[model samples]
Target: MVERIDAPAVGAPDPELKNSPIFDESDWDELSLDLELESGVCYFNDRSYAIGEFVCSGDELLRCEERGVWIREGACHD
Candidate 1:
């Protein structure tokens, strides 16, 4: 199942890959990194991110750290 969430804009969709273009589970194996997340902020690397984690989205970087989802300026959006 894919989680419903927007891709943070901090990383700018990797610039290499288009956000609209999606891949299947099988293609995930081809990627050296674990960009296998269905939703929520993620990267093209072999690592996983947890909810309530820092993510940049909506053309801006959002921090989901201890303060929870928020704008870079520390605004609580979550």
Candidate 2:
């Protein structure tokens, strides 16, 4: 006999995907323009970068991930 696994209820957020970053929507006020997710590019500081690209802001190194999301890789070194 085969068994089936139950999935979480709809609209319920996955706990694994709930990690909070220091930078969030509240920080958008410092930006000149809003970020719009492009087809295959990530938008940061009003600039568009291709996927898997890296961006350096101040001392932070950010990487462009899928879905136009920018994930912090680590600190930027000179």
Candidate 3:
């Protein structure tokens, strides 16, 4: 049987990942605006902007699993 793993606890630090610079202030601002315009929701980086769309809900963000993309609340990581 396949076991299931829970997503990292909300607000928990990510393991198996190293820090890296992702986006500058300007990039974040622009991306935020674009997402808002397209989906009516804004995304912010609690850590770094390298990881985009950390928080999203409504029809704003879509999760892409192996099966396909589906709308859902919260963040999606690859």
Candidate 4:
């Protein structure tokens, strides 16, 4: 299941990934130190996130137990 939230801009679609490409090759395995409010934000390795936490670019989908908030990104795959 997926949820939608208002963001600063509409996200572009990526047919190859079957979801919007949040991260590119460079973003792979990078730590998600902070939330992204814009589309196309990437989260890499060992990055901890939380739910209910607003991102600077995108929306939060998964909640992090330690952070006490939701993990957020620019776009999501439904």
Candidate 5:
């Protein structure tokens, strides 16, 4: 079964999604943003990702599994 990713313990609700009626927008935006990770990794209630996964931070793509520390995958292109 699918699990909910919007639980309060995961962190604050993404404002962009919270503002939308259907909540279809992404957590990303035009400016810089941050994510909370536990012990150098993100722990979602249902699953997780490792070093190779692509993390979208604002307009850039960071490649790192560790929280607070990011390895640059470079800026996202249009």
Candidate 6:
């Protein structure tokens, strides 16, 4: 037999907590570090790349991921 524990449902706000704005406009401005990031693009060395795009850094080849991050795909060849 499994024991069950009572708990609040997911996404349900707590009654004891006060509801207020988590962040102001100024805070949002500070958090907006990169404009390209808002467009679902990756930035490398001052260049913006689309998702699934590949780039070469020296000899290493990198692929742009969905989260605006570059991942190593392989080595660049001539």
**Which tens-of-lDDT digit does each residue in 6-74 have in candidate 5?**
212223225543211111124223213443333444423223435445444455554434332334444
lDDT of 5: 0.36
Per-candidate clashes, comma-separated: 9, 0, 1, 17, 0, 0
- Candidate 1, run of 10 with poorest lDDT: 67-76
Ranking by TM-score: 2, 6, 5, 1, 4, 3
TM-score of each: 0.23, 0.48, 0.17, 0.19, 0.32, 0.48
Kindly list the per-residue Cα lDDT of model 1 for residues 1-78, writing each as its tens digit.
Answer: 544345443444455543322333354345444443345543322233444544544444343322111324332234
TM-score of 5: 0.32
How many residue pairs clash in model 2? 0
- Ordered list by lDDT, greatest first: 2, 6, 1, 5, 4, 3
- lDDT of candidate 4 vs native? 0.34
- For model 6, residues 1-78, the per-residue Cα lDDT tens digits are 443322212232235542211222244445445534334676654456677676655655665655465555555554
lDDT digits (tens) for residues 1-78 of candidate 4: 456643322233334433222333344446375753333323222232333333333332322222233244534434
CA lDDT of 23 in candidate 5?
Answer: 14
Give the poorly placed runs of model 4, Cα more than 4 Å off: 10-78
Cα deviation of 42, candidate 4, in Å: 15
**How many clashes (backbone atoms < 3 Å, residues ≥3 apart in a chain or on different chains) does model 6 have?**
0
Q: Which whole-number lDDT from 0 to 100 does residue 23 have in model 2?
A: 42
TM-score for candidate 4, residues paired by index: 0.19
All models, RMSD in angstroms: 11.8, 16.2, 12.7, 11.9, 12.8, 21.1
